[model samples]
Target: MNVFEVTLQPASLKNIVIIGCSGAIGKALVEALISRFPDASIYGFSRTASFHSLEKKPDKYQEARIDYEDEASIAKCAALAAETGPLDLVIVATGILHQGEITPEKSLRDLSAEKMMALYQANCITPSLLAKHFIPELNKGSTSVFAALSARVGSISDNALGGWYAYRASKSALNMVIKNAGIETARRNKSAIIVGLHPGTVDSDLSKPFQANVPAGKLFRPLDSANYLLQTLLQLTPNQTGKCFAWDGQEIAP
Candidate 1:
């Protein structure tokens, strides 16, 4: 299916959460979710609770702070969200590609153990922890999704022109986490879907430095990427869980 199309939602989506709402894609997703599900409660979170900066906020929206590296902060937020109602969707929109002194290594000689750990913490551990706390909060009676941003480079089988050791490896670990969570969640609720999303090199700080290499029509705006990601979620079923898909709804082979 073309994820860009506004496909009719098959599941009754009610409550949603977007982690890393301070980021470009995360903030756009919050706005998309509000527009797509006007009656649904949106719990947007970031280290800064940046949703307040949005010009047009929704009445059902809730903004809060979240330290992505802290398990306590994630657990607390999950508990608070659960208290309101069952979760319909949880989007872990956080990732680290280039920030501060961290950049994708061009060769093995440039690899640092500390940088690898930092990448793993942001890309894999944080999202996996989010799943650990929030998966149970998902509505068990109906179809729901627990999705996090992954990348095309994460696929071990798809790796070509490999250079980014830490970022690629960390995202690969995240894909495993998604697969593991999907299996466990299936046992708990057969209707639940767990998967990874590849937003396809969005026009954001994360991809800005690397955009010079991107081909025409491949790079996307944050809002466009958000809608495409959401559209992929709305179309996916239980049988398709535990897999990774691109923004255009094309499955990324593991």
Candidate 2:
């Protein structure tokens, strides 16, 4: 069949719902989605009350409160978003590196159960909860993509220099959750693509401290990373589900 003959079904189109919409990448994604798919609805979910202030918010776009730690809240948000229409895309951009209470440990001695568990709750358990609750929102007409922002350091095979053990372990757990979701979703929604994406070091509060150590051409602004990641996500086929990929389109080793 010729390219014109190829059918891109409604399920293949992206009507996106973004979690953690108040974050740097989340804000950029809202703008990028609007610019790229002018007609697509972009629903944003965050715990904060300021989600409506995003640039060029679509008429169809709406915002709601979501607490990732609460499974019931996630289900409710998903149900509400699905009620609006069939969702073609779901992106989870929520993550934390170093917060006031949970700082990244530089040494083994600094590691504590409390800090590690907190990181895991924020990075892994929450995303898993999102996957568990939000799967119903995806359109089954064509290929739909569900993606979560993961970290490269989460790759167990790629670890050469290691320090942030808790952060790394938490993200690694998230990677597994995404992979497992992909497998299960494949059996049910054969056309859906569930993936884990590493967005690299972008200009955000999460990466602010690490920016000083990044090399000349490596760092990216939140908008740039979001744009690149969107393009990558759009290009994903059903066959690529359950895979982890870097921002540059490189497959990350598990």
Q: Which lDDT values do the candidates have, in the order given?
A: 0.88, 0.83
Residue runs of model 2 more than 4 Å from their true location after superposition:
1-14
For 100-183, candidate 2 gives per-residue lDDT tens digits of 887888899989999998899889988888888787678776767788999999999999998999999999999898888888
Worst lDDT run of 10 residues, candidate 2, spans 1-10
lDDT (C-alpha) at residue 242 in model 2: 89
TM-scores of the candidates are 0.94, 0.93
Number of backbone clashes in candidate 1: 0
lDDT tens digits, residue span 1-254, model 1: 42223322544778899999889999899989888888888898899733557777878898899887789999999998878788889999999997799899999998998999999999999999999999999877677888999999999999989999999999999999999999988888777888999999899999999999999999899999999999989888877779999998999988
TM-score between model 1 and native: 0.94
